[model samples]
Target: MLKQIGNYLKSKWSVRLMTIFYLIAGFNHFINPDFYLPLIPPFFNSHEKINVLSGITEIVLGIGILFYPSRKYASYGIMIMLLAFIPSHVYFIQINSCIDGGLCVPEWAGWFRLVIIHPALLLWAWEAGKSSS
Candidate 1:
């Protein structure tokens, strides 16, 4: 099972799709900061800085994964980043923070973001690792 999973992830298309996903998500940080800003933890103090920092991290990770020499490092970085953000998702759930548009986003949306998207991000990173190998 592990070997099959490894082989499946090694496919070029998997790598390409993961790369595109990372690029899109990273760019979204800059293009739609308001959407994500509400999700940031209160400890960050300044939302703007956190927004910019997230964008920068995303952009860097996206670019790094595409570069041959940095691909492994980038994949690991992305994996770590995804894990790090899990707490913010927890915070969002606890506060029931309304999404940026003022309408209350469904409770499931938070869970989806935390459970689904987060793992997908990790898988994308894993795909990057396979490609780099």
Candidate 2:
């Protein structure tokens, strides 16, 4: 069973799954604006516009990744997007609470996301991009 799972991970299906995941996430940005608006730091102007733009970008990249010719470009875009989000994650930690009065977790949970989950997410994108066949 492990070998089968490993084989799937090594296949293009993994990339497709990643793309789908992002597409859904991006779509949610529009579907649930309130959820994302709180995530934007106060320093940035036009939070709503920024959220819209990011959502559109994610949709574009996610769709671009599905095509063979654009796969590499989309993967690169995804990587860049992920990297760009680091500051937001930091901001989340700095605030030490859920943005927009959402559910608040302990500071350690925020730190764990920054220190662990974020890197793992980046690595997942990197590996998918690098291993594209």
| Top candidate when judged by TM-score against the true structure | 2
Query: Candidate 1, residues 1-133: lDDT per residue as tens digits?
Result: 9667667666666666667776787788889877788788887788888778777787788777777688888889889888878878888877774655653667888789888978866876876675744
Model 1 lowest lDDT segment of ten: 96-105
- Give Cα distance to truth, residue 70, candidate 1, Å: 1.2
Give the Å error, residue 15, model 2. Answer: 1.0
Off by over 4 Å in 2: 1-10
lDDT (CA) per prediction:
0.76, 0.78
For model 1, state the Cα shift of residue 23 in Å: 1.8
Off by over 4 Å in 1: 1-5, 100-103
In the order shown, the candidates' Cα RMSDs to the true structure are: 2.4, 2.9
Q: How accurate is candidate 2 locally (lDDT)?
A: 0.78
Query: Candidate 1: which pairs clash?
Result: none
